[model samples]
Target: MSSAKLSRRRVVGAGLGALSSAVAGVSAGCTARSGPPRRLLLATGPEGGPYNAFGAALARAVAASGSRLRIVPVSTAASVDNLRELDAGAVDLALAMADVAEDAALGREPFTRRAAATALARVYVNYTHLLVPADGPVRSLRDLAGRPVAAGAAGSGVQVVAGRVLREAGLGEGPSPARERQLGLAESARALREGAVDALFWSGGVPTPALSTLSREVPLRFLPLDGYVGPLRERYGPVYTAVTLPSGAYGLAEPVGTLGVANYLLARGEVPEAAARELLTVVFDRWSDLLREVTAGARLEPRFAISTGRVPLHPGAVAYYRSVYG
Candidate 1:
């Protein structure tokens, strides 16, 4: 990371420490016409998660676009927590999984109070990683019936989908057949290397740096999830999609079928229309730069931006698209 990038991330981390006292004032901030908001807090995922890197890239791009709207990217527990933060007025914007944004839109579990927010864009896709020891006996989801698994930490989007994968595989019940250990990507990778778990479910962008490092020691294999893509989408929403992890990713022997969920840029309903417009303008206008900076940004496409599941696109995003394609 460049010094400027490091400085930008530090600013976000510092802003996070001061947010508790600033929640009540988020809605009162400035706007595009009124000059710029004091700052826009973007709740991202954990340190090593894709959201963190992606959000940082976005923050930099928006800043460089000469927009007064400053996006401060902050580390968070991913989707569930980001929604809660949105509802709590602790953040103005966030990057969330499409499924999680849908859950909030419909007032589903983990979101008892519905958040008034909308998707700004369909940012990217998070591939489901059903990682196992290369030498282990596990070959597919069905084989994990009586084994140990790391289902990602609680409150993370990874955990939510991992739990669904287990339930759909018939491993959720029957005397706790699959003992799930709530672990984050880094911790889970560590556990896997130490022979502490039979398999781990990690949902992230391809070539997760931490996992790539772990793979160096433990050699790995992927358990396919293509069969569950349809079922997951039917049960959850349109966010679940089929994706193939290409061969050579994580040094795998061949491509692996998997479930992929769209990631979204979300903003509170209170955000001014012009502010939202300007922010997204920065995103789409300098998209190539964004893709070069954030690996996940490589998955962004305008065609898919409007199909952001139940969480409809913000008026600003729609207006921006209208001007371009119409």
Candidate 2:
């Protein structure tokens, strides 16, 4: 911590006392061992994605906070790939799904190596949206029992959550015999428009750019998944929560209630404490302005961001949480 600047005390004894105090104060101000400013890499997702916008906002906020930290926006898939970047030292910070972060940190599923990363905080929930044709009858997960569904690409977090949701609804293990297609978000949107697929699963923030762009031309229907909330919460630990996407978020008819998982900010265990403190401070202090930059990032709050599941919080983040919120 930097020492507070002190004014010279009243000189009662001799002129020597006042001179000594002034010299000491000046020396303290000049020689205080402040840590060097750092440049950090912030790994987000593809262009027009929530992570991309949020990352840019964070960068601006940090710069405005008088912190000598730079947030370099790196494009990533934000699933297992983000964890790999942190492990390989290609990036210092990343926006990652809580469940995926947990698995990688614990060396569970996709992550063969237990990632040396820690959570900064949970930012917001990524609600799963099952988008279908507006005129279709697929109002719920069960309605797609035999229809063509485009699950997201393999190795993506969207696919992981979609698979889990399907399993919880007793539709996994290929039991439903539905026509399933594996494709990316863009491909799925095209497939849905072409009638090649009846439904598509997209797990992202409300008003996702891709979904919004699709809504501009196609009449998209958001399928609700409330029935699986209880079962999903019970099975997936506390990561799954009931969330609602407001009406008109994507020019929809009404709000869509569904289950979702929180997204978290993560960093390698070796990030400097001072750097973390300043970075988090920037995020919280300039939150409102940052939200203006990334419309969806308005959900970021210091109180809500700290909601980590089982993953351990980084020591630096812990200090910030204590100093400001304890």
User: How well is each residue in 1-326 modelled by candidate 2, as lDDT tens digits?
Assistant: 00111112211121232223333333343344454446677767655566767776776555545555656566555566677777777678888888788888778777776887888988767888888888878776777787788987655678778877777766775666456677778888889888899899988876777778888888888888877788867766777888888887999778988878788889888888877887888777766765553346456777788878777899999999999989
Clashes of 2: 0
Single out the weakest 10-residue window by summed lDDT for candidate 1. Answer: 23-32
Q: Write the per-residue lDDT of candidate 1 for residues 223-244, one digit (tens) a residue.
A: 8999998888788876888999
TM-score: model 1 vs. ground truth: 0.87
User: Model 2: runs farther than 4 Å from truth?
Assistant: 1-37, 178-180, 293-297
C-alpha RMSD for every candidate: 6.3, 13.2
Clashes of each: 0, 0
Instruction: Give the lDDT of residue 6 in candidate 2.
Output: 11
Angstrom error of the Cα, residue 165, model 1: value is: 0.6
